[model samples]
Target: MTNAEHISEIATLDNVVSPDKVRLLQLLQTQKAAFLAEPYPSYRSRIDDLKRLKAAILASKETLLSALEKDFHYRSHDESLLGDIFSSLSSIDYATKHLRQWMKPQKRHVGVVFQPAKAEVLYQPRGVVGIISPWNYPVFLTIGPLVAAIAAGNRAMIKVSEFTPHTNTVLRHLLGEVFSQDKVCVVHGETDVAQAFSSLPFDHLLFTGSTQVGRHVMKAASENLVSVTLELGGKSPVIIDNNISLDAAVSRFIYGKTMNAGQTCVAPDYIYCPKNRVDELVDAIKTRYLAMYPSIDGCNKRTRVINHRQYTRLQGYLEEASNLGANVIPLGDVASDETSCFMPLTLITGADQSMAVMREEIFGPILPIVAYDNIEQVIASINENSRPLGLYIQSHDKAFQNKVLRETHAGGVCINDAAFHVVVDDLPFGGIGESGMGSYHGVEGFRTFSHAKSLFKRGRICFSDMLFPPYGKKIHDLFYRFFIR
Candidate 1:
């Protein structure tokens, strides 16, 4: 089918709701109750199933890449493969290898007031989970949570981004072939359908998108009081102390800033460097940018702005900053063809906190440089805004790095690195404060989609009879001594 046809199908909400939605909800509820009754899956069988899914994804690599490209006019095939397919496979492998340990019942200590009973924590699957993914990285955003949801033994309904019609269609087709719709379903639609999907009273809801939209999703989920995990975007900051190697710092910063054309949530939105190092860092970044994308004029490998709307928004930001007396430097010359797909990597200096580029999350190939003289000033700057989704600090001094990590609050921190922290399976990836709420990925992801039920198993002894309603002087004395004290 053509892109226009697929988009038309998604835009019309009346035809989007399949009978599968009701069937899947029922099946998921039944399965959840059964799993909770038993509370365990056959270890060997679970491992085998995960392995099968991993292999299936690997085999569909080429198809996934092609669909993603057709959806986004210029998404790099290599980027989709590496950032989405490879990451999803790695998450599944990590969960499979460590499922046994994560599933083990955790023993809890009983307080002195309670005797003849043992307490433990049982991680049981929430009946059904809803995943609302964004178009920027459709595969990873969908499969990343699915890896955790399945590992936790829960059914899921994934709502793919409407912006990526081709990718969404391809994913729905692929997933339908692999798993029964009742076990794993996919929903495709535009904004209205997506809003309805989020409003569904699922056991858990996971949303990845901008903060403004995340708020709407949360408000809708409030109708059912559904627990939600929001992975929203923010203006993540990068601080460079004078102690680091300028060359290494510049390379890492530029690579992360420009990757995926800077559509990443954790992309370094703005940088804070020592006042004296500002010029030096700017020069270094320019040198590294040229080296990376030598001919920015017609570079196909470098990603393009996703759509005209996004392109216009970015252009507005650039124009506004220039009007506000900020120096906007185009990293490389614009292509001769005005309609060229490329957007030159831009660096904006002299930007103040009041500027739109500084206030809003810049999900484009634009980088802003801010200068600070003291550590306290930098920390204050970060604290003044909504806590970012992620924070990056580059300093050779261990004390300074630790101070930044300890004093500042962010969803995640990557010391001496850019966004690499999210890939670690052992670490929880999510935001705090305005950036977002809840964490996921690896064991944390499993827990996010599951509820930790506390179970207390008591022996056949009725030791509590002494404290029954017929309170006597002796019972009151005992209670006072043990409970009050």
Candidate 2:
């Protein structure tokens, strides 16, 4: 079926969102507000709900894997189970274990001037949230935010990507089996329906996708002035300093770049290495790729581009690089058939900033090498473009790593690793500037969907009478002593 037809089929599954479901969500929000008013539910309850979600996912693992494989013809079952299923399940477990302390009201000290008043931060759910997930890593992208929204005690509407119709259908079915549609409803539609979905004045909206589309989603939400958390993509860089262990650096670098066929937001789009060490890193990466996927021609674990559209797009970048005098090195042998399911793992060297491969995000099994003579030049080059979602550095030297960390302004950084930074539940995951805005995951995720209301309880002291009179020396002195310190 055509993409549009598939989207229409899914949207027609349930012609209209039931009014009863909407009312149920409203009632849940009211109940949550009441619960917040009184003694809040112990963190244990929130954690338990996460546990339930995890159990539901685990029970449906096989079903989900099959659906995803069918959706993306070349998706690796093992890769899906590990990258998407395992990571999301682990995140849920982590959030469940740590959610109690995260939900507690944090006390903020009132200044000496406001002696009698006590101030504290009360985190309250922002009614209902809308989560719009992308096709890449469909399982994690959908459930990860749902875990946080549930933990924050907010009702959520999840919009599954239309590109992956099989996965979206399976997800809607699985979620329906696990929870009431009112609490968490999974909607599937095309770009137009998605545009309509974003226009809804949700309490908060969390969107994970490309930077260009993220802007449009934000604009749609602007009509409602709805708060948004965007996890967008950019040309995330991996910098290899001269002082690191080449062996470890190469392994992590290739592993990250090739995982999921480079369809990751945090994938190292390109690398900036010293001119002297450029050849060494390149050779190491090539050697590692051969060893890992011995026969890339029919490697089951090596995923393919999702569809012809993506394949064509990536092919265009490769063609542009070649036409622009960039050296395109095909690391693995391409299958005999030009339109075969597998595309060869590629690495381009002697690539300049002007080349399409280096200028745009190559979301495929392609890595570009850009050599730099000076560290300062590399840093300046990175800073010149839009801030990326992630910046990875491989340097055993503490000082050099610190310099990159401090100098670069990315959404997140990993000292000696690549995409693993997002695995940490405590740290926030999102982008900055053109990459994205706002963050989510763990406590940050909860906060993204919540309003941190500041509550102050003041006793009736009537000390302001001293300032009621017109400006005078005595009144000024009283004001200075009582308020201005």
Candidate 3:
């Protein structure tokens, strides 16, 4: 699989798209109506749906891995299995095990004055949910949100990115095998279809993509008053503390930067290394990267850019940085055709705010290492920018790590590691500000796709009559004084 092969395949899919938006409308309507019919699914039914989804994913494992490779030219089989397939299965497993407790009504604390009344919150399904998945990890993004929606007992309609048509086909087939169109449906097309899908009146919408496009998705969703959970990307920064081992830091850094060829939303976009340790850190990173993949020329471990358009965008970033006097260092000396899109993992020095690589999210295998004298500068630099989806710190100093963690504001933070915070099902995953808003994963995910309805039950005998309106009695005066404070 190569860039040209992906383009030719996308051309074939382009012919299969509907001539208009009729199918998109039809699918949404069907899902919405089905949701209305089964407004609140039983815990058993939700688990069953999740089970079916898990089974479908396992059944289509090979197809999914192959499609991902075709879509990305050379996506690693291990990456697909761990990132896409395994994550999806784990979500289903977690949901199935905890849904019973999640669906149970939780009791709430009441004031002593309201002893005669009882209160609890009931988790209710939010009806239909719409998910717009990006091309980078098509299956994981789509299925991840779908898992949350299913756990909350809602029907879902997914819109996968156009660049990953092969993976989209497999997803549609696999999901369709488990769920009817009304229960869970996958929509496929280019920009128009995506816009139409986003504009649909879903109960909730979850979009995972770039910050710029996230604005459009949020705007479109707002038209219908649809609550959205945007899992967006930004220039997530990594800090190498002056006290940590360079080898350990660079090893973890290399994993985060090279995974999916740095196409991840939470991938370490840039690194802040000690001013004196820049060369040593860069050398360690290069050594670790090459030791893993000696040659990126035809390595399966090196995932290619999704398409030529993306490849060109990455190349343009490098070219612009080079023109702006950035020191570009390619990690591998792979003698290969540029058309293959196997972008060598490179490090950029002298990268500043003026350069495009530093300002925007570099969704490629390019890591811009900035030299910093102190941790305060790193904290200040992070705060000055829009909040990122993730922040990484390589430090063993408990006090320093705590200080950095307390000072910085990112959707998630990793200590002594990079980009692994998202895999922790116990923690909520999302972003803030330009990175995006709202969170979904674990309990937060269930709540994201659900409506926590507050319930109150009053006893037969109460003090309501004593506090009736039409009098200024001493008791009323006492009550007012007691409550007004």
Candidate 4:
């Protein structure tokens, strides 16, 4: 079927949005009340919840893939399964396995001055978390945070991207089958609805999208004093050491940049290649992409840009870069088919920051290559941009990897690899500066959604009365003499 036909098949699914602002507010209020009713869910209950979620996701796998295909025009089932479906299931399993320990109160040591008192930290759920997910990986982004919230025993209301309404519809049905609206609600809406969602009072808000929109979400959340976890995107870069083989680097790098047609947030936005090996690197990328898919046509592996708006935006980047005399090389045997909104993997060599492709996050199948003479120059250039979500070092030299890891700042780092750290489940995934703020995955995710409440109890032997006086006395003097120094 053609991409447009697939979109037309699911066109009716887009109408599943909340009717008005009142309904959106009502959903939040309902979730808040539900959270208040069951403020702390037991470990066993949370495990059961996670199990049910996992099962439902598995059952709805095909439906979700179809909806995503309709939404993106040509996303492969494997892409959705690996990134959204299986990844979400993995998160649920990880959370389920650890919830027992995560829910336990941690004992803390008391100071000598504060002796005879017991202290512990209780993980309390932050009520009514708001999850604003993006279109790029809608299911995983929404469900990922929801997993953390559920693990922490918090209710959540999700505001999904309008660009993926078909997927939103599938999610709404799936989550609704497992949870009441009060516990977990999927909210789909337009711009005004999104504005209202961002403005609502939430205990915590987690937004995943561009840095520009994150600023707005943060600002709107500030009015309610809502603590936020902003998973924003930036220009993530890869540095290939001069000592490394270009083929080895290409093998590791191509997987990340081409996966999901390079519509990944942590996809290598740009690469730092050895100055003498730029052409070789470009050829390696093209050869590797073709090896993955011989031709864009007839192969179902290709994914299209979400819509006309994004297609136009990405096209403008290529157009502007080409106009500036940059070499815009399109890989594969076939040229991009605009009718399907499909753009083949293209590389922009000798691209500087003057081009929009380099300046902005290229959330498409476009990579810009920066040839570097020295490692320090690459580090300096990366520093000039805002911190990225992920930094990749495609080098075997431990010293080189350590130097880059020690000096550069990013949300996460993958040595001799790229972008796969997000699926590790145990590790915390997030960004720094423009990339994002705060992380959520496994134990870190559980903690992000939970409030660590400190509990202290006094022992029977209370000696504080002796030191309570209007002025300094013998007991106060004794206390001061023993501890003041």
Each candidate structure's TM-score, on Cα atoms with residue i matched to residue i, is 0.90, 0.89, 0.94, 0.94
For model 2, the superposed segments whose C-alpha errors exceed 4 Å read 1-45, 334-340, 460-476, 481-485
* Tens-digit lDDT track of model 2 for 323-362: 8888888775544123544676788888887887887878
Where model 3 places Cα greater than 4 Å from the true spot, the runs are 1-19, 296-301
| Candidate 4 minimal-lDDT segment of 10 residues | 3-12
Report the C-alpha lDDT of model 3 over 1-485, residue by residue, as the tens digit: 53234323433454354444556666666776677688999888988899988988998999999999999888999889888988888888888888888899999998977778899999999988899999988888888899999999999888899999999999999988999988998888889888878876678999999888999989988976889999999999888888889999887767887889899999999999999999999889888988888874345566887778888888888889999999989877773236778787888999888898888899988899999998888889899989989999888999889998899999999988889888788789999999989999888999999999999999778886787867898879998899979
Write the residue-wise lDDT of candidate 4 on 313-383 in tens digits.
99999999999989999988777777788888899887887899988899998998998899999888888
Identify the candidate with maximal lDDT: 4
Backbone clashes counted, model 1: 0
Error of 1 at 73 (Å): 1.9
Which parts of model 1 have CA positions greater than 4 angstroms off? Answer: 1-45, 333-340, 473-476
Cα shift from native, residue 286, model 3 (Å): 1.1
Ten consecutive residues with minimal summed lDDT in candidate 2? 2-11
Q: Candidate 3 overall Cα lDDT vs. reference? A: 0.86
In candidate 2, how many Å is residue 426 off?
1.3
Error of 3 at 380 (Å): 1.4
The local distance difference test score of each candidate is: 0.81, 0.79, 0.86, 0.87
